[model samples]
Target: MKDKPWRREQRFYSFSTDLPTRYADMDTERHVNNVAVLTLHAEARSRLHLALFGRDEWLARTHALRPAKLQTDFLEIAHYPGDVAAGVSLVSLDPHQYTLAIGLFQDGACVGLQECRIGHWHEGAWTQLPALLLDRLQRFGLTEDVQ
Candidate 1:
């Protein structure tokens, strides 16, 4: 679960939002739980979608946008009693899907990295994303030039 160099830098993310850390999210080790961090990433991703498509369009189910695959790496333990900055960027885009790169940052350092593939499904098969949607997604690409 090695993370790319740019994934550790919060400035590289095109979209970012702060999320409050909850006391219940802590584990027995006194660190924030991995599942809780993943939930933060999900919220961050939703923000990105909301920003790109607005609330109504984002919530619409006519053209379902669902995660097809996900890969995550925990780089460091996040402590409680502080806000976590969840960042998201469009890393890869295709005709039918796009990959979102997520970073969870605390105290100016990234604590985790996540890559999720979200796709549009129509009927029983994959469908091409609308050109307007693709155009909107392109505006939120990661600032870093990563391979």
Candidate 2:
């Protein structure tokens, strides 16, 4: 899916964190690898989830929040030796699944945009999101963007 018009704006994200680019994250071309850029988004999302749900609870619910899908749009090349500002915003949510929008920025420009859908499951079928978890998600979600 395409990113929203406001996805590149840092203010659009409710959660923002800076991650340092490592030499290993660079490719032979001297640009940060695409996979490494995705990894930055993963770290950002993890931090957001951890902040929404404390350590103990996050661990307990880890198995249920399975990654259902991931779509990434590479916007620009990110060079090494600089920090990438990773931002995450909640895009949509339902009883069984929710979508997260992530943007990776370097030198104040958006380098990539990614959307991840997480499905909540119990036993062998889709399950409703826990009351507490849902409440926290709503609270931490981007007010104007959450659906």
Candidate 3:
């Protein structure tokens, strides 16, 4: 079978961090619920932002991001009382838009995958990315055009 795209992305991960699967994150089945998966993605990406741009830069940024598309595929059940980590990669980048790919892993196995397109809004319009920021993004492996 053809390899999934995100599988090739592990090496290019911009950032990754452990994320506790709180008891509240589990559903009736005792596995992580779908909504919590989204939270994990957000947390991972936020951590990246904090690391790369710092809190002040992030807070003062003028671009407002709106989710354009979100695709999630659940591959396996993620059980609690186990190790969990989140990995994030910049799949596409634009001045006022970009896409991120995230993975939720439990016990060293990927349990969920998500790819989301976040559109940027600046001054009531889609803005172009500054050259320096674009260079940084490319360094983080956003080597292709925005999708």
Candidate maximizing lDDT:
2
Best by TM-score: 2
Where model 2 places Cα greater than 4 Å from the true spot, the runs are 1-3, 145-147
Compute each candidate's TM-score over C-alphas.
Answer: 0.89, 0.90, 0.79
The global C-alpha lDDT for each of the candidates, from Candidate 1 onward, is 0.84, 0.85, 0.70
As for lDDT, the candidate ahead, 1 or 3, is 1
- Stronger candidate by lDDT (2 vs 3): 2
What does the lDDT read for residue 127 in candidate 2?
A: 84
Q: By descending lDDT, how would the candidates be arranged?
A: 2, 1, 3
Q: Model 3, which residues run further than 4 Å from truth?
A: 1-12, 130-132, 143-147
Among all windows of 10 consecutive residues in model 1, the one with the lowest summed lDDT is 138-147
Q: Estimate, for each residue in 29-142, the C-alpha lDDT of model 3 and write its tens digit.
A: 998888887787778877776766668766665256556788887777877776568878787776666788777777767877777777656677766655555566667776
lDDT by residue for model 1 (14-126), tens: 88899999999999999999899889888999988888888888888435888889999998899899999998888788788999988999988889999999988878877
**CA shift of 37, model 3, Å:** 1.1
Q: Give every collision pair in model 3.
A: 95-129
